[model samples]
Each structure stands twice: as C-alpha cells, then as structure tokens.
Target chain A: MVESRRRSGRLASVPTSRNVKVSAGLVALFVVVVAAVAILVGGGDDGSDAPSERASSTTTTATSETSADAATLPPVVTDDPRLLGAPGSSGVTFTEFLDFECEGCRAAYPAVEELRKAYAGRVTFNIRYFPLPGHQNSRPAAIAVEAASQQGKLEEMYRRMFETQAEWGEKRESQAGTFRGFAEDLGLDMKRYDAAVADPATLRRVESDFAAGSALGVQGTPTFFVNERRIDPRSVDDLRNEIDAAIAGS
Target chain B: MTAAPAGTSSDAGVRRLGLVLLLAGILGLAASAELAIEKFRLLEDPLYVPPCTLGGAVDCGSVMTSDQASAFGFPNPFLGLAGFAGVLVAGLAVASGARPGRWFWLVVQAGMAFAVVFVHWLIFQGLYRVGALCPFCIAVWVATIPAFWYVTLHNLQDVAARPSRLGAVARIARENHGIVLTVWLLLVAALLVERFWAPWDSVFA
Candidate 1:
C-alpha cells in the first residue's frame, strides 16, 4: 500500500512538472517576441531616433546664441573658391541641393533671392543640382545648367532656370530649343555650349553632385546648409542667428 | 479525478484573452508616442525623412512627404495617437471590472477592421506608389496587425463565452480569420517582390 501511494504521488507530480515546463517555455517565447519587436521599433542598430537628434541639436544650438555679445561683428564673406557669396558680403554659406523641376524648389527661389538681398555679401550661397528621376523634366534642366556653366554664364542660367521653370520643356526634345534660347540670352557661344551639354565630363559632374547630396542625406530639393551647418531658413531669425554664429566662429 | 467545471475553464480563457488585449493596447500606445515625436521632427525640418534609410530598398523621406502620410490634412500620426489612446482606455476599463455593453464590443470590432484596411492602403502606397518606408510608421503598422488579430480573436472568444450568436460567429470568424491573415501576408509578399526582386526595367516602367 505504501509503495502504491508513493507511485501515485510521483505520477501526479509529473503533470505539475510538465505544466511548469510549458509555462516557462511560453514565458520565454513571449520575452523573445517582445524583445524582437523592441529592436525593430527602435530603428537603427544604435537604437536612437535620428530625426529628433538632428532637430534637438539644432534647437539647442539656437538657444545658445543669446549668450553671445551683440557688439561683436560677424565675419565678412571671403572670396574662397568653395564659397559662393551673396551681394551683401555675408560670411555664411547657403548650400542648396536643388532639383530644377521641383515645384517647391521653384517656390523657394524668391525667398532665397530675398535672403541674398537681405544678407547680401554676409552670406555665400552655392547651388548643387539634385535632379530626381521621377520628375521627367528635371534631369534635362540640370544638363542645361551644366552647358551654361561651360560657357561661364552659370549664374545667369541658374536664375533663368528658376524664372522660366514653369515655361521650360519637361521633355528632352523641347529642352534643346530652351537651352539655345538661354545661351542666346546669356550671350554665350551657342554652338560650343550645346556641345558642352553633350560632353561626358559635364554629365558626370551632375551625377557626382547628386551622389554627394544623397550621401549628405539631402532627400529633397532646396536643402540648405548655412556656414557648413544645416539650417531651416523658414524659422524666424534661424538663418540670421546661424549666419551670425558662422561669422563669429570664422 | 477532479476535473474543473467547463464554465471555469471558459472563464480562464476569457481572463487570458483580456490580458493579451491589454498587452496589445500597451504596444499600440508605445507606437503612437514615437509617431508624435516624428510629427514634431517634420515641423522642424520639412525636408526631414524618417530613418527608413536601410538602403535604396527603404527610403522613409519619400513616403513621409507623400500626400498619403497626411491624408486628413494633418499628419497620420496624430490620428494614430488618438485612436490608440481610446483603445488603451477601453482596454483598461475592461480590465478594471467594467463590463462593456454589446455596442461597445461591436465598436471595438469595427475599429480593428478599419485599422486593418487602412494599413493595407498604406503598405500599397509605400510599396508601389510612394516608393519608400518610414521606420516608425512601419513599427506602427506592425504593432497594429497583431493588435487587430488578437482583438478579433478575443472578441469572437467573448461572443463564444456568451450563448447568443456564439455558435454562428465563432464558426464564421474561425473560417474567415485564416483567410484574412493569409491575404494580408500575401499582399505584403507582393510588395516585397515589387520593391526588391523586381527588375529596374519593369519597376520604373
């Protein structure tokens, strides 16, 4: 009777052991699933939000500006090969990665030009073509600008590109006449400039610019870098403060 | 042999379902929190792309900037936050011994269904049209799927716990849930094919 009772007790405990093991297995599975989901949701392997990092860094930088002395003058624009200056000698650089055919890029021109006049030689601005292939007319517009660049009338063509963007051909064939018209307006040697557009070197340069912009995380046109730092021109005093800081730092 | 009564086992299952639904609600709430941060980032940098930057395979900026991301004239994240909040509140209420009415459970069922359909539209836009992925948005999407699945399963089980319409709904749900999840998985597979395996020639065309 004693042996039989012992055997029965062991048999009963088997179910309890099995139940414990199964529950433990389930808990482990749940933990694994939750951890996997956490890792996936955190985005980068570094597990931090990249966008907010950029924004917070900018915000902190902006807030720090109030401490600087107002009496100290900022730097004046230097005629460096890398720097493209506005009329006012502003020492800040406005580096724009732009697509000629983007409506937003076109819309931003007046604001950009206004900044140029407002800050003048205090700000140096450079434009890089970022022709997104999705927009049919953008690549041709970029090529046209390259041809104009060959003729040493790049700025004139850049301005006209934005001015007549709405009117210009979004197609390859129609862009040829538009290119000729721009060359005539800029008083360039039309034949040579047209040949430059077809040159492999010119096309390669535009492609290189696009690649560089992509590497810099320029997702869309009208991305601006002020004094080698990214800044949104839309914020009140954002461009001004950054330009001032860049001037002081220089 | 002391077998627990049938009613007791059924109650245990109901309790378990309640726990899972509550957990899913928490996940949804977490997703919405991240989404709110993304919306603020968008304000700071209109050109800001969400970090879907795994490769040319997934570019977040493309999708986030599209019209679909702001379907209601505001960012979709805001809507997600509100919706998830309601779910969290309802789940909490259910857990705290507040017995929801039939209409309340029905509303929950409809909301889950709506979420499943909306996520399908978003996945399509990301894959075929927008041609990019937002990492956080994808997180929300992933969380939403399981939340919907668990909620639907729980609702049917709850119906089964009751006598009225229990047999009919359980049979219908059991038959359809497999078909629904299978279709969802296939659609996602098709999107992945279009994005990764499709030739450049066919894709751009």
Candidate 2:
C-alpha cells in the first residue's frame, strides 16, 4: 500500500501534461478537507449562557426599529429586585443592560452618560447586569458595583469601571486586588467592599439582573430599550434621533 | 512525457488553476454552513454568546442577531455557502478538464462581486448598527477575501488585469501578479480601516 501511494505521489510530480489536472484535483480535495475540518472544529462551543459570548462577532445587524405603539405593551415591572431603573413614569425611560468587563459596554458608558445629562428629567435611566460568561472579571465587577451602591457610590463605581475597563480586561496581575484598588479610588470602605463582593445576596442581585435581561429578550450586553421600545442605533446620530423621537413622542 | 502544443499547455495551466480555486470554494462552503448552524443555535437560546463575544463593544450574538445577518432572509453566511458551491462546481468542472466556456467564469466573477458588496454591508452593520465585532464571522470574511480574489484572478487569465476590472468584469480574466497584489492590498486596507479608523470615528462622533 505504501509503495502504491508513493507511486501515485511520484506521478504527481511528473512532467506529463495530464498531471496538471490531477495535481489540481488533489489540491482541491485537500482544501475541501481542510475547510471541512476548520468549520467543524473551529465552530466549537457557542458558550451563550446568560450572556452570549459567541466568538464570531461580524454579523448582519437585525433591524431594531420599533413602532411608536410599543407603549401599549405590558408595563415594565420596575419593582422587581432585578429592575435597576425606576418604573411607572410616563416620560422616556432608558434601561441599559451592561457587563462591567465588556469593552463595548465601557464605550457606551460615556455615550449613555451624555444621554443622561442631555435628557436629565426627560429620560429616567436604569442599569441592569448581563455579565457575559467569557468575561472572568465581569461577575466580580458587578459585585463591586453593587457594593458601591450600598455605600451611595454606585454612579462613581459605574464611571470608574468604564474608565478602567481596558486595564482589567487585559490580564491584570491580580483581579481581586485590582478591584479593591478601584474601591479605594471610589472612597468606599475597603473591608465592606470586599465583604459585599463575597456576599451571596449581592451576587444574587447580579444574577437576577441577568435573568431579567433574558426575560426581557435582552440577548447581549450594552443593549438598551428607550421607553420600553427597542431602538438600534447605528451611530451617535442614530441614537440621538431615537432618543429625540421618544422624547418627542411623550 | 512529450510537451503539448502551447495552446494545450496554457489550457492545462488554466485547468490546474481552476482546481485550486475549487478547493478554496469548498472551504468557503464549509465555513458558511458552520456559521449558519451556530447562528441558528443562538436564535434558540438567545443567551448563548459564542467565545467570539468579547464584551459590550464586540458581541457575537449581538451582531449575529442583527437584521444585517440575513439580508436575503436566510443567514448571509449560507448565501456564501451557495455562492461558494457555484464557484466550486465550476472550478472542479474546469479542473476535470472541461473548458466550461467564458460565460461560466463570468457568472462566477459576478457572484463574487456581489459577495464583496455583501461583506462590506455586514462590516458596516457591525461598526455602525451593532457596534460590536463577531470574531468567527470575521474569520469567514477573511476567508472570503482570498476566495473572491483567487476566483477573480483565475478567471482573468492574466493577474495584471485586476485594477482594470475589464477581464473578469466581461468575459475573460487577465492573470498577473499585479492584479493579485491589488486585491490582496485592498483586502488588507479594508481590514485595517475597519479595525483602527472605523471604531475611533464611531466613538468620537
């Protein structure tokens, strides 16, 4: 068998004109096999969980334009421990689901803050957690944020987390230690911050936020619902337009 | 081992090149199929973000679920599979020693042109609409860039004809190193712009 295979291999290198076709065929077959293997193995596990972490990020965007009639949909129950935004108001309520470890979420932080400042009383903002599983520091980051909430420093923790997302995203020499440093920067009690992180209730709150996001059909982090209406903004202008429309609708 | 006539020798070369392109097409087909399956799985669970999900800035599930994922009602990746299949069949036929005429190659080149535009659309959607990146989808895009270029190169007998867009755009494809380099450079430029410049503009704006 080995000799026969070797003979065929030798034939491939021959100057015979027909070998061109044969060689191409063989190469084509090799490419097909390689591609098949790549698709099969490289496809791998999706690892979606509460937060989707699909490795393939380039995809066609689904249309997120919402009809003005979403107001008729069932009112959002803000009293749920998971609901971070205050509910029952008639004006535009912007609820954003975020993951602290997510870079996109961090990028949107300033934009969201700007929207908040611009809309102030016109738009009531609420934040929910949708920690992606791939982010090792995300759950801890959420816990730290909640701990800061306990100390009336939730907004500071939120801003600080976004500002320093890149630092923690890279392999921080020590995660817990690094988060503690954040706590110090935010002027929270170091011991209490540590305790809150370890606290099961705080963790539960974060987990509950994930559940709420899922229940609301929030598939990924940094998703926002303006006035309970799903709005997909392709640019800052697009987001501004959506907010403007929602505000005008009220 | 006698040498054939010049016409026959060149034809043989064409056949060999066709086979190489067929192999690329098959790989593209397989890649597209896998992407489609993964996208379907995400539809079912909604929360199942693949490893490609980096964060809020770049999420695989977010990009996949966007309207841009299915410009043709089906997952665009599957369209890639069909397109690649057409390319593979034509290439394999040519490699099998069938000429398949200029029309066949023309059609294949046209399909690839549409594919180039489609991929650009997806990139724009990711950068603008979703504001995230899907890593595997990007792999598909990378693989496609080569496949499209090679197919175009093969059809244009001389690689030098790429910048002209006359050969492949019409009936014959010119084959030369210049065309190959141009396509390669264009792909690289697109990726660089998307990676560096696009995001900065989006954020700052």
Tens digit of per-residue lDDT, candidate 1, span A1-250: 2222243432233333443455456556655764575456433333111111111111101111232443442222123222223333534577777778664566567766766677676666777777775566677778888888766677788888889876763444457677678888889887788788888887887776776655555555666777445565544356556777777786
Stretches of candidate 1 exceeding 4 Å from the true structure: A1-86, A90-93, A101-118, A141-246, B1-9, B47-60, B154-205
How accurate locally, in lDDT, is each candidate?
Answer: 0.58, 0.60
- Candidate 1 lDDT at B64 equals 55
Deviating ranges (above 4 Å) for candidate 2: A1-20, A27-77, A80-90, A170-174, B1-205
Q: Candidate 1 residues B69-168, lDDT tens each?
A: 7877887877787777777777676655566666886788788788878877888776665554556766667656755765666556545455567655
Best by TM-score: 1
Error of 2 at B100 (Å): 36
On residues B4-107, what C-alpha lDDT tens digit does candidate 2 reach at each position? 12111255455555665677677777778777877876654433455555443445666666557788787888787777788778778877888766787778
Fold similarity of candidate 1's chain A to the true chain A, as a TM-score: 0.62
